[model samples]
Target: MKRQFAVIGLGRFGGSVCCALIEQGMEVLAIDQDEARVNKYRDLVTHAVVADATDEQALKHLGIRNFEHVIIAIGDNIQASILTTLILDELGVEHITVKAQNDYHEKVLTKIGAERIVHPERDMGVRLAHHLLSKNVLDYLELSDKHSIIEIIASTKMSGKTLMKLDVRAKFGCNVMAIKRGREIIVSPQATQLIKEEDILIVIGADEDIKRFEHEMFDE
Candidate 1:
């Protein structure tokens, strides 16, 4: 059977999610308050409707509870977003993901029982800032407010050292989860594995510990 999804609010984030789900061959019901926005995705998705999601009756009319997953991507109006999420929770929707505007918005959504909350803009900004901070830092993913997983390009100082020799966990309290060399990736690399220049090291630890590891291993 085909997977079913409903995306409410056809803004950049919602529109992108709708298109991506449709591309994956999932049936997507695209909802928006703007007629023009709904019309734009009408042909691209399984269904498109202009409806006020804040109204419980309209949501029931759309059979929203039947969908396995629903995304609330309302733009700008935090009040509307919170109200819509609360109604969906009360309606017994199994999974609800809401795009949060800020920390306070996320807190409200959590209380409303949204299964997942995303801060796309804020996350992207944090990732970009990490990229700017160090040339060796290839990418970063925030696991929580204080911890993250980061990809760092191995430097000359680290090129010939084995994992056992580096003693990263003992020295810096960070774990090297994997090593990416060329097209190959080594998961849970053995302590004897040799580090090579340009290898991508996937490390996970608290933000402060990661900073310390980077400074001690890579900085001059």
Candidate 2:
């Protein structure tokens, strides 16, 4: 069976989620209060409807709880967003992801049982800043507030060194999850595996430890 996903609000973020989910061959229901927005996506998604999400009866009528995952992407209308999330929570939705407009919104959503809260603008900025901060840092993915997984291009200075020789766990407190060389990727790369220049290393650890590793390894 295909996974069911519902996205509320037809803003940029919500619309993007619908498109991406549909691209992945999943069933997506696009919901928005604006009839135009709903009609625009009618042909693109599995289902599209215009309804006031804050209305509990409306959500119930649509069987919102049946969706495996629901995303509350109402922009600007913080009150409506909170109310929608509350209704989803009350209905015992399996998973709820909400887009937060600010820190206060995120706090309120957390208190009301939102399973996931994303600050896309702020998160993308942080990831971009980290990429600009180091020559080796290719990408950054936040695992949590304090932890992250980073993809780093190994430099010549660290080439020819095996994982055991580098002692990343002991020295930098990060674990190498995988190493991508050309077209092949080594998952859970062995400690005996040597890192060559240009190899992409995927590592995960506390954010502070990751920063220390970057500074010590390439800050020169």
Candidate 3:
């Protein structure tokens, strides 16, 4: 079944979400106060309208309650975002996701019953910082405060060594879940599969262990 979504605020973040949902074959109602932004996405989404999202009457008139999910992507307007979320919750929208500017904003949204909160800028900063700090670290995704999944480039120390030989699970407490080379990806890489330079290893483990493995397995 196709899911229905309503995205309020047609800034870059909200616009991107609207486009992505449309690409995934979902019905999207794009709303914004900016006439230019709404006009830009008029043909891109199932419906595009210029309105004040903070107004409960405007939201109800647009049948926002019928949507399976509502995304509040209002940028730089905490009052607007908070008011929109509150109105959505009052209208009994099933799921609400909000983009928060900071920790304080996130907490406020959570308290108001937002189902999920995202800090895109903070997340991107973390990913970039991790990659810059570690030569072999290609990507880093935070699963929780204590756990993460990372992609690391296989280095000389790991070249010619098999999973069993390295004993990553025992030594570093990290699991090498997959190996990627060029366009090919190997899931559950065999214990005997020799690691080669330039192979990207997808690893999952506790945060501390992942850091330890990166520092110990790769030469800086």
Best by lDDT: 1
Provide the overall lDDT of each model, using Cα atoms, as 2-decimal numbers: 0.96, 0.93, 0.94
| Candidate 1 segments whose C-alpha is farther than 4 A from its true place | none
Give the residue spans of candidate 2 off by over 4 A: none
Instruction: Please provide, for model 1 over 104-216, each residue's C-alpha lDDT reduced to its tens digit, 9 standing for 90 to 100.
Output: 99998999889999998999999999899889998999999899999999999899999999999999999999999999999999999999999999999999999999999
Candidate 3: segments with Cα more than 4 A from true spot = none
lDDT at residue 183 of model 1 (Cα atoms): 100
The 10-residue segment with the lowest total lDDT in model 1: 211-220
Estimate the Cα RMSD of every predicted model relative to the unseen true structure.
Answer: 1.6, 1.2, 1.4
How does candidate 3 score on lDDT?
0.94
The lDDT, on a scale of 0 to 1, for candidate 1 is 0.96
The residue pairs found clashing in candidate 2 are none
Give per-model TM-scores. Answer: 0.93, 0.96, 0.94
The candidate, 1 or 3, that scores higher on TM-score is 3
What is the clash count of model 2?
A: 0
Worst 10 contiguous positions by lDDT, candidate 2: 211-220
Pairs of residues at least 3 apart in sequence or in different chains that clash in candidate 3: none
Rank list by TM-score: 2, 3, 1
